[model samples]
Target: MHLNYLANIGRYIPEVILVLLMVGLIILEATYKEDEKNRKYIFIATLVGLVATLGALIANMSGKAEAIFSNSIIIDQFSTLIKMVMVLGTLAAIYLSRFSKDIYESLKTEFAIMAVGILIGGFLLASANNMLTFYLGIETLSILSYVMAALKKNDQRSSEAGLKYALYGGISAGLMLFGMSHIFGVLGTIQFAGVAKMIPTLTSAQLAILMPSFVLLFAGIGYKIASVPFHMWSPDVYEGSPTPVTTFFAIVPKLAGIAALIRITAVFFVVDSPMKIGWIGLLIVISALTMTVGNVTAIGQKSVKRMLAYSSISHAGIMLAGIVVINDVGIRSVVFYGITYLFMTLVAFYITSIVQDKYGNDHFDRFSGLIYRYPFMAVMMAVVMFSLTGLPPLAGFVAKYNIISSLINSKNYALAIVLGLNSVVSAYYYLKIVRLMTLKPQESNEEIEGFGFLNQMVIVSMTVPVFVLGIFWETIMNLAAGAKLFIQ
Candidate 1:
């Protein structure tokens, strides 16, 4: 029995490494004076630790799938792939925090600490096989996020953002728990497998009770992904938080939520029943609304961060569209979309962060005539924008294409059409930056010091994948195809 537990621990090394890394950072942070601006060792240590965690996840990818820790968690390629994406997102955000001027120098270390802690939660949530572990994961991710959002203690907007996040999170958590309790009461077990076993056999009375319970349960996951209705806080929080934090939010928690949602849809709805019909109907409505609402609202946003915030919400809707198909192809498409999204989002935010640091704001005008000053960055931004709009021969196009194809294969024509229309609507805002960068005059002749050679190289390198993945996506699609959920 003890040997079995020890083996489970072996499979869980990535999260363990992160926990140890967080503690080490705390101790290292204390050794420095409070006012010290540069903490190079802390940065170095964080990078090394994250790299190690990524390596562990890569190693885990080839292993067999199994439920561990008393079957509360499952280790599988799907969860492992999502974890890798989250780790990569964290790594980028940490690097960005190292130089971003928005965050207080003293608070930078705290950001790294909180980020890793949230990542641990994300890992748990991605693989959670039961309601108990699922709720624990959501709370862990939420509490740290509240602190990270309000990271700029002196900034009133940041404080408001944090408070709003906390209040909403508390309500969402409570409702999710309430729903979970009813589920337990009806099914007599918190285990997801047990719930699945009971779902197909449910009587009409039980189905009535379970349907609403499932909707309530979705509230928690939906909030995390920033889907429509539950997405009220996303733009405000994204705008109010530091750019690095915003970047992290766009990638990690959102993908983690999608991963969990995919698992639930695949597991609970695998067997055909009336409950499956209700769930799919709910996803279809939410997916269309989320996509339309996000795109329509983004058209008027002036702040680049806020625009991206809505953009992310819309992107989440697209990912949800992938889940609506409820098949291996849908799952693979969502995974591929996530991989491409991580790169595009990171590059966009990295450039935006650097530009904001230079200009003291992320307004659209800040990018005016960027091509004249930094043509390479201007082109990179243009490419990402085009890709974001689902243009041809770019990663975003392929990602969107995969999802639409999957939907079409499944005859989900309406949602696919909604996704297509949303992409057109998105072009207005995404291309707005492109037009400003190329058509407008330079804001100033002064060079943005943030675009130093090394930083420029890093941005360019990140953008490389945006192009490569678009053309050579088959390799990645195969990898994504292998990320199957372990259903027991």
Candidate 2:
């Protein structure tokens, strides 16, 4: 028993380091005064911890799959990859917040602590194998997100974003728990492995109970991924939250949420299972609706932040189509898409944050004459826009290609076509910003601030990946293919 315990500890070293970092940050915050010097130290400390966590994750990826703590969680390649993605997203967010004009400087330690909390929750969600652990992870992420959304305390919109998020999150959580109860009642087990074991034996009546239970559980996942019906709060929250927090919201939570959903879906709805057809059909419909709503609505949005918020919904729908495939190819596409998305989305938000810093608003008009003012910055933004529009030789194009191909391979042609059309629809809005940046003259020749050397390095780092990955995507595709779930 002691040996097993030690082994589990060794297996989860990365997660352990993350938890320790969280505690360490809290202690540092408590001891240090709220001042610039201390905030800088806290930021540095956070970055060091994040880098250490990443190292630990890479070191531990060679181990064989195994469930720890009575199958509450399973440490494997799937969890390792997703956890790394979450950490990377958090790192970007922390740095961005350190430089952001909107987030209060005094709250640096608190922000780092909360971000670490979300990171830990993401780690938990990625490895969860039982209903109890799943709910714990989801709530950990959701609750911290509410606080993060309200981090801009003086802003009324931020407060409203937090409140709206809390209300929506509460409803989603309640429904998820209710669904878990029904599932446990029907199958007499809470572990995903147990669900699989009992699925074939289920009667028609039990399947009936299961279907609604699944839908209810999906509501919680849907809310996290921000699908069409459950996506109402995202635009408001994304617009109101500090830019760094908004970027975090756009990237990390969606990845964790989808990772958890993929785990659940793989366990319960295998290719040959009777349950497969029902969930796939539902997913297809959701995918189509989410894509259409997200792209169509983004075209009319005046706020750049809100428009990106809608764009995130469209991305979610595309990834959801991959989920419906219920195969290794689908999982690979999702993972690859996830990696590409991390870069493009961060760059987009980074640019938005810089523009907001300069003009005091994130309107498209703020970016007028960007090319003439800052040629490098303008070109980088253009690359981001084109990639998002899924034009060739950019990572977003490759990501979208894999997704659509996965859909076609699964015979989900209609959804694949919807995804393709949505890409075309999406180009109008993405390019609209490009047009404003290049064609429209600025209202004045006033100089813009921000985009310092460090910020430029950050932007270039993210931008280069979007371009490089488009040319050489095999490495990421292989990594994604290798990170398949243990169950499948």
Candidate 3:
């Protein structure tokens, strides 16, 4: 028994490493003087630690799936892949925070610390095998996020964002707990596998009870993914938070929530039941509404950051579309979409953050005549925008294509059509930046300090993946094909 637990630790190394890293950063941070501006050592340590965590996840990928720590968590390719995506997103955010003026210099180290802590929560959520671990993961991710959102000490918007996030989060958590308790009371177990076992055997009366309980349960996950109705806070929070924190919020929590949602859908809905039917119906409505609401809302946004926030809500809707199909193909498509999304989102935010840092806001006009001063960056942003619009021969196209194809294969034609229409609607705002960058006259000839040669190279490096993944996506699709949920 002892040896088995020790062996499970091997599968858990990545998370352990991150916890240690967070603690080490805290200690290292204290050693520095309060007024120290250049915390190069902290930056170096953070990068090194994140890289090591990525390495650990890569190593875990090769191992067979297992229910570790007495099945409280399941380490599988699906969860591990999502963890890798989250880690990469974190890496990019940390690097961005290093130079971003949006966050206070003193709080930068704190950002790294909290990011790792949230990442740990994401890891737990991704692999969670039971209700206890699942709720714990959500709370852990939420608590840290509230602080990160308000990192700008003097900014009232930041404070408001944090407060709003906390209030909404508290409500969601409470509702989710209420749902979980009802589930536990009715089913007599908090273990997901046990719940699955009881689901198909549910009486009609029990089904009626569980249905609403599950909807309440979805409130928590849906809030995390920023899906509709529960997505009210996303834009305000995104606009109010530091850009780097917004970037992190876009990638990590959203992906983590999607991963958890996928697992719950796949595990609990496998056996046909009235509950499955109800759940699928609910997802279909939410998916369509989320996509429609997000795209329509994004069309009028002037702030590039807030626009991207609505856009992310729409993207979450697309990912939810993948889950609607409820098969290996759907899961594979979602995973592939997630991988491509990381690169596209990172590049877009990096450019936006850099531009915002220079101009004090991420208004659409800030990008006007960008090609005149910084052609490379303007082109990179254009590429990201095109990809985001689901234009051909780019990663976003392939990602969208995969999901549509999966939906078609499943005869889920209605949602697929909705996804298609949303992409078209998205083009207006996404291409708005492109038009501004190319067609408008230059805002200024002054060079953006954020677009230094090294930073441009980094942006280019990230953009290359967008192109490569579009044309050469088969390799990744194959990898995603292997990322199946391991249900016990």
lDDT of each: 0.93, 0.88, 0.94
Cα lDDT tens digits for candidate 3, 237-343: 99999999999999999999999999999999999999999999999999999999999999999999999999999999999999999988898889889989999
Off by over 4 Å in 2: 1-3, 35-38, 478-488
**Per-model TM-score on C-alpha atoms:** 0.98, 0.97, 0.98
- How many pairs collide in each candidate, listed in order? 0, 0, 0
Model 1 residue 260 CA deviation (Å) reads 0.6
The count of backbone overlaps in candidate 2 is 0
Give the TM-score (vs. native) of candidate 1: 0.98
User: What is the clash tally of candidate 1?
Assistant: 0
Worst 10 residues of 1 by lDDT: 479-488
Q: After superposition, how far is residue 373 of candidate 2 from its true place, in Å?
A: 1.0
Off by over 4 Å in 1: 1-3, 479-488
lDDT per residue for candidate 2 within 323-342, as digits (tens), equals 88887888878887888889
Query: Candidate 2 versus the native: TM-score?
Result: 0.97
**Cα-lDDT of candidate 1:** 0.93
**Candidates, ranked, lDDT:** 3, 1, 2
**Which of the two candidates, 2 or 3, achieves a greater lDDT against the reference?**
3
